[model samples]
Target: MDVTQVLRMNGGDGDYSYSNNSLLQRKVISMTKPIIEEALTKLYCAMNFPKTLVMADLGCSSGPNTLLVASEIIKSIDKIRLELGHDKPPEIQLYLNDLPNNDFNTIFHSVSTLQKIITNPSCYFCGVPGSFYTRLFLNKSIYFVHSSYSLMWLSQVPEMAISNKRNIYMSKTSPPSVIRAYYEQFQRDFSTFLKCRAEEMVSGGRMVLTLLGRQSDDPCSKECCYIWDLLAETLNDMVVEGLIDEEKLDSFNIPQYTPSHNEINNEVKKDGSFIVDHLEVSEVKWDACTGYNHNLSEKDTQGYNMGKCMRAVAEPLVLNHFGESVVEEVFTRYTNVIKNRMSIEDTKLVNVTVSMTRKG
Candidate 1:
């Protein structure tokens, strides 16, 4: 599918109440703030002089997480200014960017709520709508760049792999060819993303990125907390039910790039532009105590209530495959499967957060 179609497929003002919940994302924001703040301090110290700082958050989806990141940057700058006792700190130009179809209205509303705290009229806020794989800012302008839970979505898979009709991504068994194709596309998009950002960032600028990743090499293996097997099983059931065409299934992929720490280090080295300053993988766990609690263990009525929370991501993909008419039934069966599985013990949702920074 083309970019426009892909956006349309994923676009909608569904019940994204969970995505906006601050409580759940707060933990993540708090955990990542120290690392980002440290990077900023190092960058400023290296410059050895006060200067205008331009920061951009690539793929900043409309949610509390976006604002949380922006607030962290502002606070860090404030702390630095106080330490040096500067009468006036350098200006801050903050850019929030995402796909063109993102909910800019919600994002703007969130920004407005912060107007009281971000009192400086010199502090600028702008919305940049575009793909991060391509250019998003002017050359030699940005001082810091950060992205979270983004980057894993590639622009598109390799064309050759799609044309081969190998069904590498979705077959009765594991398909290494499909896995390799996905990796190649990730590498290309990631490389382009770095190059584009490099052009916009000053020579001494720093970048901190966090995204979903895996530490294993097995295509079907488990890592951190993401269970590909469960997801595959869910999709396979749909295929068997004739709700979606098996051929079309291979046409689209999640495009998640779960690179190992070493692989990521190597990619940075190959780029010959950014120096790897910090690379660490940590487990991000989601549990019942989190916001918008959804699981199979809930009673049928309670589970349905929680299942409504998942429509944001599921509805689009399901609608694209099986007409919109089947959404209710599809979701019903899907949720039922979860409820059934919950009877078993030891099931949890987990993700890996890979944090990296560029040389300043």
Candidate 2:
């Protein structure tokens, strides 16, 4: 599968669309706001107050959270300008980037809504469609960059010599060779991503990246593997019941990897283009809302809610592999699996947030 063409969140504002079911992603954006503010503040001071600020939001899936991020950045910069008593506000050029298949229409159509929230006439928006793995901006053109919940997706699924055997991602049963293959693929993709960004960003430009990661060094840890394990389990059950082909189940693998902090740091140091400012790992509840309350509810609908969330991100891939006939049934069984698992024990996803500065 072409990761650039096939890997995208379900678009539009329907009930199962990413725009509606992206509460989890939206929550992630909120969690990283402080990191973004800190990076922007430092960049503003270090750059001697440039008249124009060029920034890009990579992997900006079509959703309310897309503009929400832009609004937050504009608000923070506006606040900083006012505090510093700048007579002229800087013109902000934000490039919202994603794959070509992304619903750019929805994003462009929502500009008025963003205007209602932040009526900054100086702020301008543009849509750049392509893979972030390749260069999207001119050399030394960008002043700041932010990406949330995107880098976890590799450029493509690793080419494995041996079949992963019914598992859609790394698991305890996966062989050492399989694990090595996944890690090596990430190393290449991430290094290329860094090289491209290093060329695009100006010296001392700041970047804030937040992505799903594992707390332990083990790639098969529950923090990163459980979700896909449950998904594979559901598919296995379907195969047993003759609902899906056994060979197909054995062949399917997700083009995603959750790296540990050590792994990420190694890549950054190896790339030799950026200096790490801050790196942290935080836990977010699987179905937790973005409010003061942190408790997981026992609501019966939580299972379906989580199912929809997963569907929003994974449906397109599933449809491409298994056909649309089995999409609903697959997620239905997956939801029941999540509900049962939640009843037994609370589950959480680990998120890694990192801030970096381009080396001068």
Q: Which candidate is the best by TM-score?
A: 2
| CA shift of 123, model 1, Å | 1.8
Over 47-143, each residue of candidate 1 has an lDDT whose tens digit, in order, gives 7745578899887777666777888888788787678676677788899998887777777887877766764545778999889988888888888
Q: Which regions in candidate 2 have their CA more than 4 angstroms from the true location?
A: 289-298
Q: Positional deviation of 123 in candidate 2, in angstroms?
A: 1.0
Model 1 misplaced regions, further than 4 Å: 3-14, 21-26, 119-121, 160-172, 224-229, 292-310, 336-360
> Which candidate should be chosen as best, given lDDT against the real structure?
2
lDDT of 2 by residue, 1-360 (tens): 888889999998897888888887888899889999999999999999999999999999898989889999999998888888887889999999999999898999998789778846888899999999999999999999999999999999999989999899999999888999999999999999999999999999999999899889899999999989999999999999999999999889999999999899999999999999999999888766322223545565666677788988999999999999999999999989987886677888999988999999
Cα-based lDDT for every prediction: 0.63, 0.91
Error (Å) of candidate 1 at residue 274 is 1.1
Q: How do all models score by TM-score?
A: 0.83, 0.97
As a TM-score, model 1 comes out at 0.83
